[model samples]
Each structure stands twice: as C-alpha cells, then as structure tokens.
Target: MQNDDKYLKSKNENPGSGMPIDEMHELDRTLGFKERRYIEELRILTKSTAIDCIIDDRFERIIYVVRQGDMGIAIGKGGDNIKKMSRVLGKRIEMVEFDEDREVFIANMFKPAEVASVSFGERDEPVMVTVPERGDFGLAIGKGGSTIEKARILVRRFYGKEVGDILIPNRGNL
Candidate 1:
C-alpha cells in the first residue's frame, strides 16, 4: 500500500462547479492525476459522487466509497454499472456505501460476509471484526487476502485505525 497516497479523498466539488474548496488534510490532499480522473469518471458514469477512491494495483481493483444512499444507483440494475465500469477501467470495481459511524462503516466494508459485530479498539489500536460463520470469515478475507487487505488499507486511510483481525465465532483452525 505504499502508493496509497493515491487513495484520493473527494474535495466536495463538481468538475465544472465554481465553488470554493473546503479544507482537507495534507495527506488527504495528495490525489494523483490518475486518481482525479477516476473520481471524475465515477461521477460521470455512475452519477454518484465518490467520497473516496482507492486504486489498488496489487489486486488490479478500484475501490470506491460512494456517498451513502448512492449504492443502488452506482451499481445499477443487475450490476450493469459496475460491469460497465470494470470494462472501461480494465480493473475490478468494488463499492462500499459510506457511513458516518465508524463501526457501521467497518461492518459495511465486509459486505456479503455477514459481519456479526465490529469492535473498535482504543486510539492507535487495531479493530476487531467478528463474522457469524466460518464461511463468512473466508469471504471477508477473500482470495489471497485481497479483501481484508483492502479493508485494512481503507480503514487506516479513512479512520486512522487498523483492522487487527477478522474472525468467526466458535470456529477453530481458520
């Protein structure tokens, strides 16, 4: 995740809107040219504003955190929008509906995995995620650990925290 600085945080402006830019952290302000293009493209194609975008080259994926309530529109019926974006960008596209609550947001990041609970750690400590089943554990972690890695990078980027572990209750040898 060395190039995670390219994980751009949206500046809350339209491409052509002549609005004043809001304050952003120095780290959040380091969007690369390609990331800016991706963000703009997301807005144009999906008609949904992406709050953050992570260009994960290792997995050849583009992870977008879209504004809450925009997930359906972004994905479109039968996932047509995602399919189109994937074809256009030459990369897998994943979207997480943004949430203001850190715990809920972390849980949402593990979508399709049935997260049982999210336990937040104290300052600078890693958070713990509990899934309902062993199958959920595998799904949340993903092939070659890609899903969990993406979650870890994004949690650190957006929440300034880490995901210490993802586990299934009453399961052993995972």
Candidate 2:
C-alpha cells in the first residue's frame, strides 16, 4: 500500500507545478473587485470616464487612463481625487487621458511644439512624425536627445517597432 501511494504521488508531481490557474483566478477576482470599486470612486469624484486601469503589483502602482474632454475634471478640483485614490489604494496612481482621435493624442504628446501630422511608415515598423518650428530643435529632441529618444523607445517598447524618422517642418519648406 505504501509503495502504491508513493508511485501515485510521483506521477502527480508535475515538472512545471501544473500552471497556477487557481491562484490566477483568485488574483483576477481580487483585481476585479478592486477595479470595480476604484471605478465607482472615480465616478463619484470626477464624473469622467475611466477608460482603463492597470494595476502593477510589482511596482505597487495603479495607472488609470481616462477619456475626458477636460483634464481638470479628471484630475478633480485641487487634485483632491488623485490624492484620495492614492491614499486609499496604498499605491501611486498615475492618470493619462485617452483621446478617441489618434491625432489628438499624438498632438497632445508633443506639447509646446505643435505636431503637424503623424503617419505610420511601415507595418510593424517605426512611425514618422512632422512637427512645427519651435525655436530650439534641441528642446524638441530633449536634453541629450532624451525626449525624442524616449518617445522612440516607448514606441518600440509598446508597439514593437522603431520610429524611422521624426521630421520638424521648416518655415522655408512651408
């Protein structure tokens, strides 16, 4: 009987721990509850649409992307909602607006310097952007070209492609 039991145990012991599906389900349930509550709180506070919520357990942070016509309303009066949410969640909360129009979002990203256009270069490839003249090209590129570089990195990191070119339109060209 003891030998038989040992053989069964050995057979049941999977090499890869048999995929933690039960644990994942539990985590999903917990996250769902938290997300629902957070959405409710946000609705009460701002009356804006919470487009998406990303909970990063490793960083202990919650990133909320909201679709709002007015950023002020999403942030709340005097940043009260953000403060409250951060305190309640016990995690840093970052807010970003979700624009229905892709152009609007891209334009918003290149602040101060107006973006003329954003066009995809190739499939699974980099993007090409056109920006208006804004005094210092260095500023547009950012310190040590960090700004544009970071944007490129983010594009590749998020979209799985590099940005082929970034063109700043010259007054002479126009």
Candidate 3:
C-alpha cells in the first residue's frame, strides 16, 4: 500500500515537521479494542499519549510506546504512574519512549543495558544489537529472551524491521 507522500518524506526534506517518526511512517499498527482501552486508561492515569500499545500475553505485560518528551509525564513523579497503571491493568507495565532514529529506539527498548551499537543485517535478516559488556547481553535479552522478543515485536510494529539477535565481544550470537 502506498503511504502518504508526506509520511514518506525524510527529516532532512521535511525539517521541523514536529511529528514523530512513528506517526510519519504509516504501518499495519492498527490497535485492537483492548489495546485502545489500555491506551485510554494510561492517558487518563498519566496524561501522556501512547502512540502504540502491545499486549504480550505470554509475558503478561502491556508495553506502551509513549511519545518522545512525554516519558517523564507517563512515568510520573517517582514512577507512580507506572505503578498505578500496572495495578489497574493487572499486568506489568513497560514504557518505551518513541524515537525517530531507529538505532536510538532500539537502545531505548533495551533500557539499563548499554547498547554498544545497532546494525542492520542482510536482506530478510534481523537487526543486530551489540551490548557494551558481557553481562549486558543477559540484561538486554532479559530472562528467557523476553526483552529481545518484545523489542523485535515493537521494532516490526513501527519500523517493519526484525531484530536478528544480540551479541557481545568475544562470544558470538546468543
């Protein structure tokens, strides 16, 4: 399907658009009734706009992609908003700040884990994320690969990209 010509314009070509990449790039990110409800609940609770919401039943969590610059509000003072939202939603709450840059967005998804670099693989291959430290590998991947899986899902949702895997120095793909 053809995206809006405006949505296809690059930042350099459309300077000062004041629109986030997620909004600019049209994808198959249609929200379901439950996802919409969750987003509405979060907006009421934190007064932050969620551009996308993913319900990962296997992980028992709802991941909200808050607009950039609105994380502080979505998180609220001392993370009260997240705590409250989690309680109300009856699941773990994960908030990722929206970023126009693909690399920065990937790094944001793997919070607390310092990403050394983000690289794209060959055609049909997944994106490769490198962590600074060996320990960070586990942190980025999360227990049972939940973190990486979630990151892959969101990356595909917004960018239509895949996360091949994460790697660290010395050791190969994990």
Whose TM-score is greatest here? 3
**Candidate numbers sorted by lDDT from highest down:** 3, 1, 2
| lDDT, candidate 1, 52-158, per-residue tens | 78899999999988777889999999999999999999999999887767678788888878889888766557789999888899889989998888889877776
Q: How much lDDT does each candidate structure score?
A: 0.75, 0.52, 0.79
Give the per-residue Cα lDDT of candidate 1 at 15.
20
Q: Each candidate: RMSD to true structure?
A: 7.4, 14.6, 5.8
Model 2 lDDT at residue 72: 69
Number of backbone collisions per candidate: 0, 1, 2
Winner on TM-score between 1 and 2 is: 1
Q: Where is model 2 more than 4 Å wrong at Cα?
A: 1-33, 57-59, 107-117, 128-174
Q: Candidates sorted by TM-score, descending order?
A: 3, 1, 2
Worst 10 residues of 1 by lDDT: 15-24
- Tens-digit lDDT string for candidate 2 (1-174): 012231121222311123233421222212377775776667676676664456656456675655546466867788887888788778876564545454454444444455678775455555666776645344546555544654553344223445655576654321
**37-146 in candidate 3: lDDT tens per residue?**
99899988898887778999999999998777889999999999999999999999999887767678788999878999988654456789989788898889898888
